[model samples]
Target: MKLFYSPFHTFVHKVLVTAHECGHWERLTRVATFPFKNNQGEDCGDTYDISAINPLDKVPTLVTDTGQPVFGSQAICEYLDATSRARRMYPAPGPKRWDALSRLSLCDTIFESTVQMVMEQWKPQDQWNMGLFTWLWPKFNAGLDSLERGAERGWDDFDVGHASMLHAISYLGFRAEFYEAKDPVYPHYNWREGRPALAAWFDTAIQRPSVASHYNQPFTSDSSAEACQAAVRECIALRAAHGQ
Candidate 1:
């Protein structure tokens, strides 16, 4: 399989966590995409060559050995669950499944809101929109509060939902400086305060091998991308050495 992603893309990292948790981290070729800007520093093409497969031209796009394309974190992560024989995160239809899916929705909602805010920040000050903060900012905080309240259930097993939450929370701290910038509309609250259960849960869960491997490095162009390339290279070498 071949996957196109940007290390700073929180959504893309969800797929990475899914792959790692499924014990197939070394099975795919990880390709880095310049989603923001190319070497020229010009505005990026919304649909780089990846657009050929995904019209959105988004990262976290995957192409399986059979040449089937899977785009978006949900499709990619669920695809991994369907194809792999390892423990499945998508529990068989039950209350647990519904609960997990609900959490996934809340977490991804927060992720999307943050993506919008960050993208808006990329624009000049004059073009800023007040509605984003008026509407989206509160919701993002509410979602985090929801997760913190459910800390016990949120980080229980590191399933697909857990992967979603992990990616979301990690990015908040990872991009702390950006989020903390002088944007009155943007939120700069302490996420760990008054949430000992969730804080403790994340403190431990973030150390898992899947997370520590990809996210431990600075999430910059050279650092994170280089780390991902190295992981893929190592995975390939291991597979080759084992004659698989």
Candidate 2:
């Protein structure tokens, strides 16, 4: 299988965690893809494009051994869980499943909204959308509060929801540290403030083998577009051979 995704290890990736938890990490061929470079017109040319397999040309796209393409992160993670050789990230249908899915939905929204905020900050201060920040800040606060409550309640085992929470929370910190400009609404925002339970849960969760596998680690594999394209071609051939 081939996974085309942005090689940003500063933040946790739920897909990577799910892959490791499902025991499919070693079997995956990681292809570093930066879809943002294309949007930024960063002179990367067409090297990072994977639109052939994925119409959206988004990252975290997985091409299975049978050459089937899975795009959305949730879909890819669930795919990994469904085909697990080790532990499962999803629980069977029940109240536990519903709670896990609810958390997953909430955390994923936070992660995407945070990405939107990051993108808006890419513009000059004068051009930044204050309304976007205003609209989103309250949502973020409420969402984090919800997560804190959930964390206080805790769970019996690590699930897809916890992986997503790590993904969202780590990126929240990364945005603060990585950018030079401060967020207008929460310049020195600290998510851990008054959210001790959530912070505690995060601290312990990061130690899991799934999270530790790629968190804070540098991408040492081939990151060139040529390598990524080569893998894409291989998948295309596989698809043709399988008549898919």
Candidate 3:
């Protein structure tokens, strides 16, 4: 199996991390593709002819040995879980499976909103649209709040579903301080507290060789300060374009 992905993407990272945790990394060939690039010239593309296989040109598209194509992180993850005989990532069919599916759906929704937010800020200021942010931020917060409430119910024994949510939340923190700042007021503010089981689980997952490998240096060799400045400039330019 060939797993084609762009390391710069958090969604792709999530899938890769899960695959690694499920013990399928060894049987898989990692194909690095560039789907997102920065001003500094980081390029991402697809390995297979995307148009022929996937109607939508996207990264993280997996091609099985039988010439089957699977797209989307969630779908690909499900495929990985189904094709592997190792311990199942998702629970067997029943309430547990539904529960996991629901959480996975939530992860997809929140991640989609987050990506839109990033794109909204990537454009020139004159082309920016505050309305988009206005519309999405509240939805994003609502999703986070929902996750917080779910976490409060005890995600320590997080099945595959809950694990995906945790990864999404942590990825937001790792990528954006804005979300981190808002986490204090989030519904389950102390979700990580008194949850040694979950904490240990996350600790182990994050440090796994596959997961750790995803933390490769940023696409750009620019200094941290420079990156921040560039991001700020982009945001400001975007806002200015939108007259926000």
Which structure among the candidates has the greatest lDDT?
2
Off by over 4 Å in 1: 9-12, 38-48, 152-156, 218-244
If the candidates were sorted by their lDDT against the true structure, best first, what order would they fall in? 2, 1, 3
Candidate 1 residue-wise lDDT, 1-244, digit = tens = 8777876643227788788777677886667765555323444333234555667857778877655668898999899888875678787798779878988888888877777777887778778786886787678777877887788555446678888888787767756666666465645656687778888988887777778767755444333444544544544565456554
Q: How accurate is candidate 1 locally (lDDT)?
A: 0.71
Q: Candidate 2 lDDT, tens digit per residue, 1-244?
A: 9999998999999999999999998999899998877645556778788998999989889999999999999999989999999999999999999988988998999999999989888888899989998998899899999989988988789999988999999999888886525788888888999999999999999999888898999999999888888888988999998999
Q: How does each model score on TM-score?
A: 0.81, 0.96, 0.67
Show where candidate 2 strays beyond 4 Å: 39-42
Shift in Å, residue 4, candidate 3: 1.2
lDDT tens per residue, model 3, 126-183: 6767677667656666766665565446553445675476566665554464343322
Give each model's whole-structure lDDT.
0.71, 0.90, 0.59
Clashing pairs in 2: none
| lDDT of model 2 at position 151 | 81
lDDT of 1 at 83: 83
Native-structure RMSD, model 2: 1.3
Winner of 2 and 3 under TM-score: 2
> What TM-score does model 2 achieve against the real structure?
0.96
